[model samples]
Target: MSTRPILALISGANRGIGLAIATGLARQGAHVLVGCRDLSKGETACKALRAEGLQVRPVELDTTSTASVTRLAERIQQSYGYLDSLVNNAGIGVDDDPTLTTADRLQRTMSVNVLGPILLTDAMVPLLEASGRGRIVNVSSELASFGLRADPDWAFADFAMPIYQASKAALNSLTLSYARQLRDKGIKVNSICPGYTATEATNYAGNRTPDQAAVVAIRYALLNGDGPTGTFANDHGELPW
Candidate 1:
């Protein structure tokens, strides 16, 4: 067995898809760091995983806060020294309301869904570089697809969450930029549309379970250096940009 223990960091992992991904990675023998804004929830999640004989630990992280991101970086540096994979899974949704929407709503949505990942990735680059087989997986959505957005025949047109859609689109662009910059550094960065997953965030409207989404994410996380970069995928195949 490869003794190079895979160190993975998953944000917003207290519950939902983030927690599911953490559990899946831990099951595969990866040392998982679960980042959550709530300490109690984080501890609970850690305990649940530990009970299953999985290696997991809770780390305090609020992606919207720069100070929190810096502190998380320092904590990881002190404990693990390096990270093999990073799953930028934290995100939020804005209620569909064109009349009530304000700049604050857009800002908050973008800050959490888009900017947060950028800051966290920037903070963890050194650790990823040190790993030599680094993988950065941004949990994007099908709503981010420009082709889908432009096509009236697309199913997503039936449900219009403009703020959330725009944020994911921005995240996809960020993934591309990062993948390009890190290409020479041996870090493979890619975006994934986990499909419509059933979670609290989605109010259980989705047909797929969180575990199903986690499988796709873990697959990307464990991919070799030769794997595709700057691409998007679901359970079936690659998606259109």
Candidate 2:
């Protein structure tokens, strides 16, 4: 086995912030696992990373699918037996009639954004515990900020994508709860607001690049054993709860 001290798994890593984080970690001598829904896209990403001489492996993981998540867990257990970091980066933003958002949309968004991560983390907790210094990075957003929701000047408040916003809020709450539960287990769990990253989900309206956002995620992923947990931060600073 290579003597690399880090092993990282990032979901939805075929492109955007997830891809950027995988590349960054791989460059830092970590064995990066690129978890994607599309096997072709995963292979393409893996080839690109390998071309750059980064240790990257592609793993199929559709976060919304329970079967996929279970298979992913099994594969990781058999392949590495431990996980140093897990970056929950998979999410979806369905554009339906804001006022008439159906229950299906709400369920879908919540499944992928909230329940999916919870299940994945639960499945991987054992592997993380095996690593003894594991870290969990939940890729949250500023829109999830309850404080921002209360403020009229928060810019995104008027945006009526309640399903997406609420899903992320639930994700942030899950992060805190999981962090508290894992605090004594030598694992650190934290949430990050990527600050309007220019990804497909945002229609590129975001000012910050995916690579820039990846930096913050990577920092949280590589934190020391005593680092802060159950917190939300961005490139600017820590966001108010």
Across residues 90-192, which tens digit of lDDT does each residue of candidate 2 receive? 9988846465448878878888999889988998899999998899999998887889889997788787777888999999999999999998888899999
Global fold similarity of model 1 (TM-score): 0.95
* Candidate 2 C-alpha error for residue 148, in Å: 1.7
Worst 10 residues of 1 by lDDT: 94-103
Summed over model 2, clashes come to 0
User: Which RMSD values do the candidates have, in order?
Assistant: 1.7, 2.1
TM-score of each: 0.95, 0.94
Off by over 4 Å in 2: 1-3, 97-101
Q: What residue pairs are clashing in model 2?
A: none
In model 1, the Cα lDDT at residue 200 comes to 89
Among all candidates shown, the one with the greatest TM-score:
1
lDDT of 2 at 77: 93
Candidate 1 residue lDDT tens string, 1-241: 4587799999999999999999999999999999999989999989978998999999999998999999999988998788999999999986554555578779889999998999999999999998888899999998879877778998877777778888989999998999999988889998898888899888898888999989889999999857999998888878877
